[model samples]
Target: MPHTKTSDGVRIAYQVRGDGPPLVLLAGQANDHHWWDDVRDDFSDVRSTVTIDYRGTGESDKPHLPYSVERFADDVVAVLDELAVHRADVYGTSMGGRVAQCLAARHTQRVRALVLGCTSPGGQHGIERSGEVRRSLIQSDPEEARQALLKLMYTPAWLAMHPGPYHTLGDRSMPAHARRGHLVASNGHDAWDALPGIVAPTLVLHGTDDLLNPVANAPLMAARIPGARLQLIQGARHAYFEECRDLASPLVLDFLDQKAPLR
Candidate 1:
C-alpha cells in the first residue's frame, strides 16, 4: 500500500509484487492495477513486478485538471524515482502504452525494455464508426460497451467462441475518477512522428482483428522503433492479455527475461 507523489503533487499508488528483476505494469484506459490480476502472477517466474495506478485511476489521487500524455509519463517516472529504481522493463497497454512510448522517447535511461500492447501511433486516428453508433456506445451499458470494446479488440468469431472470459471483463469496473481521466487522456493521445525517437528495446503487440486500433497500427509502430519486433496475436482483441493470457504472458515474460542482464 505504498504511494509516490508526482511533480504536480498528486499521489500515485503502486504495488510491488513477486521477486526477481523489476518489471513495471502500466494499465489501459480506465483500468487500475487490478486489471493485471490475471497476468501479474504469471510473470513471477521471470521478474519482480510493480503495478501502478496512474494519477487519475485506481487508488491514485485524482484532481480536476487537463490530463496530458506527458503528465502520465511523468507519473510513471515519479513512481520509479520514489521506488529508487533507475531502470525497469515497462509494460503498457492502450493508453498506458502511449505513456510508455513517451517515457522511452524522453527518459531513455529509465526504461530497459518496453511492451506496447494494442496501441497505436497518434497521428493515425482509428475507428470511423458511425457518429450515431459512437454516441449510442457512450451511453451504452457496461455489458454492451464491453461487447463492443471486445469486438473492436478481437475478431467476431473469437468473441463468439469465448463468452465466459470476455463477459468477465464487463464485470470489472473502474473508479469514477479513472473514467474521467480516461476520456481526457484518450482524447489527447496522438504520437505518429515520435515513435522513431523511442530508444528502448521494444515489443509492439496487436491483434489482427482489433477494430478500435487495427493491426496496421502494429507495423506502424514497428517501422518506427529501430529494431522493435511486432507480434500479432491472431483472433485476439485489445484485451489480449485477458483473452489470450497463455500466449501473451510467455511472449512478455521472454522479453522481460531477456532484458534482465541489461537492467
Candidate 2:
C-alpha cells in the first residue's frame, strides 16, 4: 500500500497500475480509489493509472474537521510530488472534477491534459441536484442510501438489464461521517472564475440523464474552459462511465492520445 503525507500531515493511500503515460484518477464524493476499479483496467493497458483515497475516506486520515476543495486539490499535488510526477493526464468525476478544476487552476503546469466527468464548476451558476436526489444521498442507513444512489445513478433500462451490477453498487457502503465530510468539501467548491485559467486541453463528459449533477452543467464548464470538448452519453445517467464504459473508455483514451498543439 503506497502512501504519501500531505503538508498538513494527513496520509493519503494510493495505487499505481499498468504502464504508459501517467493518468491520475480522482473519485467522486464519498468514494475512494475503489470507485475507479471498474474502468481502471481499460486505461491501465495504455496508461499508468494512479488512484488515491482522498482525505477522510478509504485508508486516508479522517480528521473530524471540515474539508474543502482547495485542500483536496493540495492533497492531489502532494501525491504527485511524492510519486515524482511533474505532469500527468488527470481524470476527475463528479466531486473529483471539482478538485481537478482547482488543481488545474492552481497548478497549471502539473496537468498535461484534463477530463471532467459529470461535474460542475460550483457557484451561483452551477446546477445542483433536486431535493429528492439530495435526500437520497444523505440517507442515514447505508443500505437505503445505496439503493437510492443506484436509482439516481443508472437509467431504469440499464438497471433492469444489468441487475448484477446494480445490486453490487447497492451493496457498497461508506462511513457516514466520511460521507458528510466529502459532501462538505464538495459543497464548498467554487471554480467558476478558475475554469478560464486552465490551460491544459480538457474533455468534459456527461450523461444526458444525470439526475445528480444534471447534464446542463457539462456545457457550462466546456464553454468556460478554452478548447474543452463536451461529449454527452445518450440515455445514460450519473454513473455513465461505469454503466457505459464501452462508449466512455474509448472517448477518454482517444482524447488522452491526441497531442496538444504547441502552446
Candidate 3:
C-alpha cells in the first residue's frame, strides 16, 4: 500500500501487482483499487497492473467537496508520478472510463493506450439508461436493489453461480457527502468534446446487453477516438469486464501488445 499527494494536496492510495509492461486500472464510480481484485492476477503474467483509490473512496482522502472527472485523472497522474511511471496503457470501466477520457485527452502524453469498458461520454450525447433501470437503482429495499443491480450488471447465468451480489458492488461505506460528490462527478461528466482529442490507441468495450451505460455508447465513443477499436462481449451485462474477464483480459493484452495506429 502506498499513497501520493495530488497537485491539489489530496492523498491518493494505490497498489501495484505483477511486473511487466505497466497497465493502469482505473475504477468506476465509488469503487477503489479493490475493483481489480477479481482480475488483477489474470493480467499478472504479462503486465504490471496499477490500481488506485480515487479521492473520497477506499483509503484515499475523503474530501467533502465537489469532484470532477478531470480531478480524478489528475489524482491518477499523481500516483503514477510517485511511482515514476510516465506513460502506461490505461483501462477504465464505467465512471473510470470517463476519467480515462479526461486523462488521455487532457494529459495525452501519459497514456500509451486506452481501454474504455461499459462507459459513456456523458452529456446529452451519451445514451441514457432505460426508465426501469434508472428506477431500479433507487429502490429502497436493499435486497431488491441488490437483485436489480445483479440483473443490470451480470447475466442471470453468471449470477446463478456467483451468488455474492454484495461483493460485485464495490465498497459502499464511503461517507454520504463523498457518495454525493461521486454522483455529481460522474453525472456531470461531459467528455463529448474531449473524446476526439484522445490520441492513444483506444479500445472501446461494452456488453451487448449493458443497460446501465447502454451498449450504444460503445460504438459512439469508438468512432470519436481516432483509430479506436470496438469489442462487444457477447451475453455479458454492465460488469462484463468482471463476468467475462477470460475474454477481456486477452483482448486487452493483444491490444497493448500491438502497434496501435492512431490515424
Candidate 4:
C-alpha cells in the first residue's frame, strides 16, 4: 500500500513483495496491482516482484490529465527512485508493456531486463478491432464493458473457466470522465518508433490469438530489438497471463534467468 510522489506531485501507489533479484511488474492498461496476485506466487521463488497501480487505475490517484504513457513511465521512474531500486528487471503487459519499453529506452540505467506480454509495436499491426467492440467498451455499464473487453482479450474457454477474475477485471474499465482520454492514449500509442532503442535484454510474449493487440506485433518487436526473443503462446489471447498463468509464469521466469553473454 506504499505510495510515491511523482515529479509532478501525483501520488503513485505500489507494493513490493518476495525476495530475490528485483522484478518490477507494470500491469496492463486499466488494471491495478491485483492483476499480478495470481502469478506472484510463481515468481516468488525466483524474484522479488514490485507491482504498481498506474495513475488512473486501482488505488493510485486518478488525476484528470497527464495520464499518457510518457507520464506513466515517469511515474514508474519515481516509484523506483522512492524504493531506492536503481535497477531492476521490468515486465509490462498491454499498456504497461508500452510504459516499460518507454522506460527502458529513455532511462536505460533503470531497467536491467525487459519482458513485454501480450502487447504490440503499436501502429504496425494491421489488426484493428471492430467499431462494435470499441462501442461496447466505451458503454456505460461496467459489466458490459468488462465482458466486451474479455471477449477481445481472452479466448472463450478461458473466459468461462475464470469468471471471478474477469469480474474483477471489470472494475478497471474506462472511468466516465476519462473515457475519451483513455481511448485516445491507448489507441494512439505507437511504440514501433521506440522499440529499436531498447538496449536491455528483451523477451516478447504474445498470444497466437491475441485480437486486441495482434500476435504479429511480437515479431516486429523482436526483429527490431537486437537479440530480442519472441515467444508465442498457442491457444492464448490478449489476456493470456490472466488466462494461463501457470504456463506463462514459468516461461517468464526462465527467460529472465537467462544469462546475457559476457561483455
Candidate 5:
C-alpha cells in the first residue's frame, strides 16, 4: 500500500497493481478500494489498476469536516501526483463516478479515457432515488440498513447465487462525523456544467433498474459529455457493474484499449 498527503493534510492511501497503463478505480461514498475487488482482476490483465481509500474510509486519515465532491476529486489528484501518474484511465461507480466527473472536468489533462458507472451529475439535473428506495436505505438499525442495501443493490437471483463482498459494501465502523461527511459530499454533488468540459473519451454505464441512482441520468449524462457513450445493463440494479460485469468488463476494456497509451 502507498500513501500520500493532501494539501489539507489528510493522509490518503492507495494501491497500484498489474503491468500496463494505469487505471484508477474510484469507489462510491463510504466504500474503499475494495469496491472494485471483484472487477479489478478483469482490468489488471490489460491495465495497472490503482485503487484508493477515500479520506473518511479504510486506512486514510478521517478528519471531521465539511466535504464536497470536488474535495474528493482533489484527494484523487493528490494520490495521482504521489504516484507520478501523469495520465490514466478512470472508472468511477456510484459517488465515485461523481468524483470522476470532477477529476475529468477540473483536472482535464490527467484523465485519458473515462467511465462513469451508476452515478449522476447531481443537483437539479440528477434523478434521485425513488422515495420507496430512500425509506429502505434510511433504516435506523445499521444491520437492518445493510440488509436493506443488499436488497437494493443486486437482483434477488444474483444475491441468492453469490455471496460476494456484501459485508464490505459500506463502512459502519467509521466515526459518525466522517460518515456524515460522506453523505453530505454525495448529496451536495453538482457536476452539470462540468460534463461538457471533459476532454477525455468517456463511457457512461448504468443499470436499467438502478434504485440508488436512476438509469435515466445515464443517457442525459452521455448526451451532455462531448462524445460520451452510454451502456445500460438490463435487469440490473445499483451494483450492475458487479452483477453483470461479464458483459460490462469487455465493453469497458474495448473502449479503454482503443486509445494508444500516452508516453
Candidate 6:
C-alpha cells in the first residue's frame, strides 16, 4: 500500500519485498505489481525486490494524458528516489523491457544491472505481434482478451497441462482504457539506437517459442548491449517467467549475484 509521486504529479504504487540489494521488477503492459506475485518471493532470499504499478494500471493514478516509454522510465526513477535507493538491479519484462532500456540509457548511474525478458527495442527493427494476436489482445471482452493473450503467452502443451493459471489470469483484468493506453505507449517505444549505450552488465532472457516477441530479438538485444549475456529457454513461450519460473529464476538469480567487473 505504498506510493510515490512522480515529477509529473502522477502517483505510482509500489511494493517492497525481502531484504538485500534492491532489484526492481517492471511488469509488462497493463499489468500491476501483482504480475510479479508468483515470482517475487523467489528472489527474497537474496534480493530486496521492488514491484510497482505503472500509471493507468493497478492502484496508480491514471492520468488522461499521453503515455510514453520515457514517461514510464521517469516514473521508475521517481519511485527509486522516493525509496532512497541510489541504484539497483533492474528486471523488465515485455513492454517493461522497453522502459528498462530507456531507464538504463537515460539514468545510467541509477542502474547496477539489467535484465530484459521477452522484449524488443522497437522501431523498424523490432518484430510486432501478428494481426490475429493483436485483435485478440484489443478485444472489448475481458475474458476474450485474456483467452487470446493466453494463447500467445504460453506454449500449447503448457496451457493444456496448466489450466488453473489460465483461469487465474482471466480473473485479473485491466480496464479497457488502461489497456489501450499501455498498448499505445508500448507501440511508440523506440530504443534501437539506445541499446549500445547501456553499460550495466545485462542479461536478455527469452523463450524459444515466444510468439508475442520472437526469440530472435533476444540475441539482437544481447549483441547490442555491451557485456550482455543471452539465455533462451527452450520449449517455453512469452510468459516463461510465470510458466517456467522454476527454470528462469535460477538463471536470473545467478546473473544478479555475479560480480560485475569494475568499469
- Residues 1-263 of candidate 3: C-alpha lDDT, one tens digit per residue: 68998877788889988888788988889888877788888887777888999899899999876799989998889888998888888999999999999999999999999999999999999999989999998889987987788788888888889876344475787888888888899999999998888999899999999998899999999998889999999888988888999899888888888954322
Candidate 4, run of 10 with poorest lDDT: 165-174
Maximum-lDDT candidate: 5
Off by over 4 Å in 2: 138-142, 164-175, 260-263
Relative to the true structure, candidate 2 reaches a TM of 0.92
State the lDDT of candidate 4 residue by residue for 1-263, as single tens digits: 79998878778889988888889988776677887777777877767788888776767777788457777788888988998888889889987788888888889888888999877666645346557766877789977876777787778886677666442253345475454555556666777777788889999998898777778778888898889988899989787876778788888888878855211
Clashes of each: 6, 0, 0, 0, 0, 0
Displacement of residue 225 (Cα, Å) in model 2 is 0.6
Candidate 1 residue lDDT tens string, 93-209: 877788888888889899899999888766544333346546645754866865566556556665677664432232134557566766678767777667788888999988776
Number of the top TM-score candidate: 5
Better of 4 and 6 by lDDT: 6
What stretches of model 6 exceed 4 Å from their correct place? 138-142, 165-175, 260-263
Assess candidate 5 and give its lDDT.
0.89
Candidate 3: Cα lDDT at 236: 86
| Residue 112 displacement in candidate 5 (angstroms) | 0.7
Tens-digit lDDT string for candidate 6 (1-263): 99999887899998898888899998888778877877888987778888888898878988887889899999999999989999999999998899999999999999999999999988988877678777777899978887777888887787888775442242145666666788799999989899999999999999998888888889888998988999999888888998899999999988987866312
C-alpha TM-score for every candidate: 0.87, 0.92, 0.96, 0.89, 0.97, 0.92
Worst 10 residues of 2 by lDDT: 165-174
Predictions in order: lDDT:
0.76, 0.86, 0.88, 0.78, 0.89, 0.86
lDDT of 6: 0.86
Cα-lDDT of candidate 2: 0.86
Off by over 4 Å in 1: 124-136, 140-143, 150-178, 260-263
